[model samples]
Target: MTGGREGRVAVTMPQLGETVAEGTVLRWLKQVGEAVADQEPLLEISTDKVDAEVPSPAAGVLAEIVVGEDETVDVGTVLAHVAPGAPSPGQRAEATGAPPVEPAAEERSPSPPSGERSSPPAGGPRHRHSPRVRRLAHDSGVDLASLTGTGPAGRVTPDDVERAARHAAPEPVPSPEAPVSVPTRAAPQRVSTAAATEPLPSLARSSAPAANRAFRTLVAEVDVPAAQWVGSSDQASVPVPGSAAAAVVAAVAGALRSHPSLLAPGAGADAGDLAVSWSTGSGTTSCLLSQAGELNVGGVAQRLLAGATAGEPPPGAGFTVSLLQDTDVLFEVAEPPPGQVATIVFGTPTRRVVVVDADGSPGIAIRQRSSVALSHDPGTVSREAALAFLRDVVRRAHSRA
Candidate 1:
């Protein structure tokens, strides 16, 4: 399409990490001939660690669907292609020698051997090898024909074998020392498993215990002073070594560092509940785990946002047990002015939502008039003075509303 990839953007499956071996195609949201935008989800993919939505790297007509659903492919495979604002095939008569095919029709097209839509010749499937896969084969000087089956329906396994067979591959000729072997240890091979963690102390902080039923929700929120907002005061001359969010993360990380306490109650030990909350300029989150010996519910929002914004995730942030702290929060749901929650992590106004896409992130505007300097040596103010500040703001805001 588009004359050999000119102006085309490649939507490749991300290689999350070295330990991450490969992924499976669970489904495709968009398909060939579909109109798509940059960063829009093109397909749903699953790796060992996650079930993730694969986004288009750029906007264009989803020019081609290179991989099939339920197919497993290695990282860096080009799952789909997007050209810069290219019209659907129907609109651009010159591309693909055909017009834009309807998105719904193409996406629902069944996988090969069923022959619903047009089928490639019996010798091979129309869509099989990914563009990146082809490139890698060429670069590694691999003969795909020689590779044996590992993937679905005899599809060639990628990368791991490619890299291994290419780099650390057995040389055409070998040295004698390479065949040396060590004696096996004289012990039985044992498989060990660690138990699931006990609930966090903060999760247990609820005064009223919620019943475990079919489904439910929990809610919490926090406030921020305008002066401490991210954009406040040109945000210091130099980048601070740590963000306010990072501080919150550090506090929570500290909680988990007490591994024995975090582990669930077992082996005759009695556990108590611990309640901790984290808050930062980014947002606020509360944690309640019913366990004994710690209640570190401090700066949860700060902990999460710091980890999210840190550009790298901290330990324990990846678990489902971990949750986001909402920055621009709205407890009451409404329509239009405050749109419905998007299916996935999406940004918003009013409440700065980092979306669940990332681990971390802030809010609220407080006026200088609401606060006053303390006169005593210890820098403390009287209770009556604090009440006046709260009542005054309530009156000011109520009058405005």
Candidate 2:
């Protein structure tokens, strides 16, 4: 936060992450002259990694907006200004350098006499409507003042305008020469009790066919001891149980940063500014990290834990990592959701006998290992690229271990 002219305080674009240098203003939750509470969501912003709501730094009236919606600015740039105290309407107008607005006709000192014509109410719906909503109403030929507002504080929302426009749309008249046919109703089919009793397949299961058509899966084995060591070591930033998961996440993040080709076309332009979805027992959460490629195992763990705890997932993640620990399943091909490019599934680690190279010869030894599988969209990512990425993830994980 910075200081503004007069007694107003400046709200600048915050540095969201280590690698993020800029952000785009998405929307203003509070317009100029509106009183906002401290920590209240003031606006929405979009960066390469994630979209988030920025909160007000102090309780005050929003004095001015220096940055408009959709404008991109560098970090630390002043975005707006907020006056220190709750000002009256006239004071707000003066602080914003705008002329004081007159009261609505209904609230005027003297009402229009003898049916004399009076101007429309100053506080009509248009006054409270956002620029976007007003534009939409104008384009859709909807009357703003007549519609009942369903939004907060009786504000006319875009949806309400759209709904009114749809309802007011003129019906087409049929020509006399055109033949009209009566529509016949079809009989409803009866469902058998057994069929109805059968459990419905989950959304992922039902979409498997379509997702499989464009996706490819690759599986690899990782040394579980290395991951466990990183997880339990003092260097680990997250809890012991989640340390391994963090290691995997860090590896994936590094791989994505190193090989942008692994991501869908437009998704890679941001380079290291990437966000990944993490699926755990609680739910899937989108985690955004700063300089993920340079972050140590602990740093990755901390970010993942924070995101999971927040519960509210940010949008625009093309890659996902799912943890399926504590299960016997060696590896499972997890399908990516719509708009997602790929998913990595980690299986439970288990002790297994494997050939170990000792001094000068190979010998049988017991070791902990886990199966990891990568499910990616073949249409966007080639098999070779996917395999290379998977290999890179394993290599990075081992490097940290």
Candidate 3:
């Protein structure tokens, strides 16, 4: 956030991730000359890592829009300007040369560029199809130019392409004896279990450019005695009745505090106040815990219990943890949610026979173990940093157990 001329504030494109160099302005929530409150959502922007709403820097009237919807610009570029104090409609119009309120329908809908196919005469309006939408249209054998857009400012969204595809006549199926010619294109990367239920078309509709980003998954096996420790009621050292799941969450939070670099590069300097999104059976829940590093296993358990009972977790977290303890899943690769740096998944713990070093002597023993996998955007979190964070989590979990 920066100050501009005439006591106005500049709303620049924010850095959504460490490797995100640019972003596209998807929509402007507040039109020019519209009164905006401080920290109010001013616009929505899409980057490779996430799609997020950019908030206003100050309470004032939106004086000017330097960047329009669907326009891509470098990070830190001024997207708009807001003048402090309430200025009259006439004064605002004179200062910015924009209408006092929303523009007329005709003025709002601009003509498509030359060489682009124009919409049919009976169509709603001209629209700009994003690359993902165009690809989906091509794959589905749907003509984007002929479809009516339902998105903001007449944008051709993936839904329109999917709808068109579903309505179009199906092509004849090739016989078993016929030869097939596969298109020469790179295979699409697999989405994580978190999004496995969603259709490909729906995934394409996501604001984050998942196809363009590089992701890495790391897996580690950890010995967890917390499962037994939590089940036992006779332990005198137990500060509070906590579940193994809550202990894992506390361990991850502590690791995040110790290794700040494991967080998204754009996650600011204060790592103590971190938000973590965790998965319950019903759905995902986000919780913002202050000084999370300082929280113990019992403290985290209480919070989790409260959130589950209330059906709402604390809002805001750039990290996610998915617990698949009850299932037979051994390990899973989970993609981080949009705008988040990484996701940690815990698989079901099982008894395993292994050799252990006891008092400097190797011995055969049966132990309980679980596989923890960390999926992260390599651009935001380095491989080494992720490994260290995972190791720390296991270490902390063992100590707590």
Candidate 4:
């Protein structure tokens, strides 16, 4: 945009990835003196990982054009500027205070849905999210239906986007569990699969006059939290070693695929989105939690598991849904159980663990920024039997609640 004194606008093509070199300038969102609002759609960009739209920083005349359309520019390139008083920068340093640039929707990237890669690890068992969050997802075309968290104690994080992309880039050959490379022609047109990137949906300071720095999120109840189940020294207390945890993860993933909206608060709002992850700490094992600024656990998870069934595949696009975290504490989003309340329990060859929740609680026994932990306990009261009883209680409570 024009940099003259008459206009105080500052526009730039913000970067989406730490490693992305260049992106195609597919189109522009605004024109000269467009009377734009802060964070208004200013342009669109199509990169190797995403085809996204950018928002304007302020409301003002688009006085000048530093770069014409169709020019492929490096990150931090000066494209245009909005005049002063038009907009203010957000506290979020990540946002460039500009709109999306470059073309969009031309080609889909091999990125993980929403990038759960940066979330939690998936090498162990899976956890649960909300079901209500799933139902609302269908209406938005966004998927809360399938994110894997990797935060402390298996919580999800915004950075999971990067991890998700990396997971989506390559598929492992099943037989030997090895990375497989296919010839370009045999595979769908693929871009860099291993690089990390982000979707910067930053709003201009001027756009949100009422919501300057902080906003409130939604609240939810766990109703009946998770618990374990068993009968008669039961169905093989543990699966084949690592298989039990895998099954737990698979079950949780099934829930996410059935539900979608657990990822966000409402249509188009970003902050309230839920995050799930897992980790291993010094004392015990745990799942970390970091809620969306405005959302509660039940509200998000309830919507996420509305239509899902046990065998159906989870949603794997637009949002990150995978075991993509680097540390043990992180995990991808698992499935949300149906009903107002849900339950979970784990039994190993030698240990039994059960977690409980009430209607008002999200069922998380412990909560923290870094983790909500559980451990491999071998010495508890009637560990195995207690585990089974708790699971049944949670399931019934959820159904009745």
Candidate 5:
């Protein structure tokens, strides 16, 4: 290990938000003595609202594991340390202040708690395991301290937990009236008796049905000549205020203003109207419940992008629009989250824009071609209203352009 604080870099728990003072270490991508790159995903942290992959601050060898898996620690707490390069097992032990103790000769066989690989010493460091393994152990009522790990460096794995569980379980006692060996043809009778004696599956414990969604889809193509822009032609060199997403958002918002009934009154209303908001970047399909009845498309678009970038939920919008820049794929289907009126997914140009020549010849033209999908609550917004809303958006887009 490198000397002093010169080579060692402390890996601290980050402050995700003003309210989030602590977070749980969900998983570590690199183990002790492993090399890691700067900005690479080092570990996963789970907060109340988001699960994020925390990136490494600098490229180095993971030298120490301070905070164990599933351990919750306050923000700025040092989770681990990184050195300049990888260290040998002996060197690692020396660096971490751990005594270098080898397994006894009798512990050669690879079995849980067998031979010299029994439980750790009373005051010695406990065997290191992953968050997943610890969680499994907890749920299965297996004692981590009692089981010998089979993973590298004797770290407890999920497999070790499972094996411990099997060993810890009590065997079922045989009934006084045991049945004699049954012929192959009579196996069904034995199975029937076993089934009859077995307890039925707990209905209440079973997973519930998927939540209901009022889904609606609208597919339309609007012609947008390359010249369609909001800025003055004199300032042609300057970038336009409207991106493909922003323009669509503004158009939708303006159209919704015409039909105010489509806008929801508040969040969490089962059958209320919905407001429209647009999203930036690619991610899981989601709706931001918005209460802004009359909204500025440009401002709302900026806010949506900023909020998503910060890993915060967008303001309440009855319908959320996600603009996907990835154009390689031609089509996709997305559903709205429950409690929202709808989620609109707008795709980049897919189909070609063309113009008919006066001589009846067809030629390709430069235009923006988008595929729009609206997943709406059928109970609150009818299919006809959804289609009309989409048409109005196209009209607005054309008029603005």
Candidate 6:
């Protein structure tokens, strides 16, 4: 862009990340007419994973500001211009009590103007925006350009972004079966597994948005019986010790293979890759589980524990799982950061195993147990898909017992 005055150096947006195509102008540290030194901070830009200050390219007066704070623009777009010994547009406007004017230009081929701060071509309306609205849109994955503002002067608002995000989210599919189970008068109350146990449909499609669509997420959780998994006490005290966690991971991975929508490529065995987090006496540790083939629970647990002891970051995987022992707490779904699809949490084992006698009377056993949960995006993973996978885990664990 031309400087707000005669001949100046053009300052364009710089490339920030390998995957970033656009960035939001978080703020302008330097205003028009301000003097700047080369390499000094001039503005801030934000992307999904980064927030950084952009420095001035050359030492000079800030003659013009092309992109305003809070605007989102493609990389390489002109942000401003700097000219040596020139009065900035803001200063000139103030001194003369006149509106800020565009820089003088030589006769050039006419074209549409779509730069950061430029108005739309004739016949198209102008959109007004504020910093708060821009930040809100950035955080919520909403596009201001796609929204119709209700604020005065046609400015976008926080409420507008939130409403747009909500409207963009996919509608949840109702479960065919009632999730809540009524407690029997004679038996103790059972925790609800409704979130995870929806009946599976023969074929289901993910509600996850396409790359071009607004990013919207949905959360769900399902509880499973701990006894079905840890019926054999000896299984828990074996060579690997925390085989329970490994077994759960294996079961989840195996189940995910059948639910392609939850997997990365939307299908395949590799899509079943998972990251598991298990608690140790010291703290928690995470490890990657590639295939469900062998499921060496003890070996996996040992590696994870070793990494935690050495203070290493968790291994990467498609999805994440966490196991918390000896608590009455049930699993709950939590919001994940950008790019993560789902999280499975296993809570404290059941206090005691319930058994049936020859008389058909339920009695307490010496074995302890707990429940597991799967929190997933309803758009990418349907309730039916998650429920089916959870059920499969219980079935596989029981068969091993």
TM-score of each: 0.26, 0.42, 0.42, 0.23, 0.36, 0.39
Error of 4 at 268 (Å): 35
lDDT of 6 by residue, 177-222 (tens): 4443322222332333343243221000112223322222222222
Q: Residue-wise lDDT of candidate 1 within 213-305, one digit each (tens)?
A: 111111112222222222222343312112332222222233222221122223111232222232334333333333322323234333322
Clash-forming residue pairs, model 3: 275-317
lDDT of all predictions, in order shown?
Answer: 0.36, 0.60, 0.60, 0.32, 0.52, 0.51
Query: lDDT tens string, model 5, 1-401?
Result: 33336668888888888899899998786666555667666788988767787877777556777887899999889888877553455545645565434443234221222323244456354466688776556544567888777888788887787566444543233232332221222211100111012211111111223453324455555544343222222433322224445566666666665443244434322322333322223222223424323446556445334333312224444555555444553322344543455555555554464464746877666556655655455455555456667677778766644
For model 6, what is the alpha-carbon lDDT of residue 141? 51
Question: Given candidate 5, what's the lDDT at residue 14?
Answer: 89
Could you arrange the candidates by lDDT from highest to lowest? 3, 2, 5, 6, 1, 4
For candidate 5, the C-alpha RMSD (Å) to the true structure equals 26.6
Global Cα RMSD, each model: 26.7, 22.3, 20.2, 24.5, 26.6, 19.7
**lDDT agreement of model 2 with the native:** 0.60
Candidate 3, poorest ten consecutive residues by summed lDDT: 195-204
Error of 5 at 315 (Å): 7.2
Better of 1 and 3 by TM-score: 3
Residue-level lDDT tens digits of model 4 in 1-401: 12544546567767787777676676665554334556666677766777667666765544456677788787777677665342222311112335424223123221223333233344422344334333322222223325655766655443443234223322221122222222222312111111101111111011112321111111111122232111112232211112223223333333323322222212122322222221112111112122322323343333233311222122222122111112232211122211101112221111112244577664534421111111111111112222332333223333432
* Model 4 poorest ten-residue lDDT run: 368-377
Error of 5 at 217 (Å): 1.1
Ranking by TM-score: 2, 3, 6, 5, 1, 4
lDDT of candidate 3 over 95-185, digit per residue (tens): 5675655544334222223232333235422355788787556544467778777988578887776666445553332222221121123
Model 6 ranges with Cα > 4 A deviation: 1-241, 265-268, 279-283, 292-294, 298-316, 326-328, 353-366
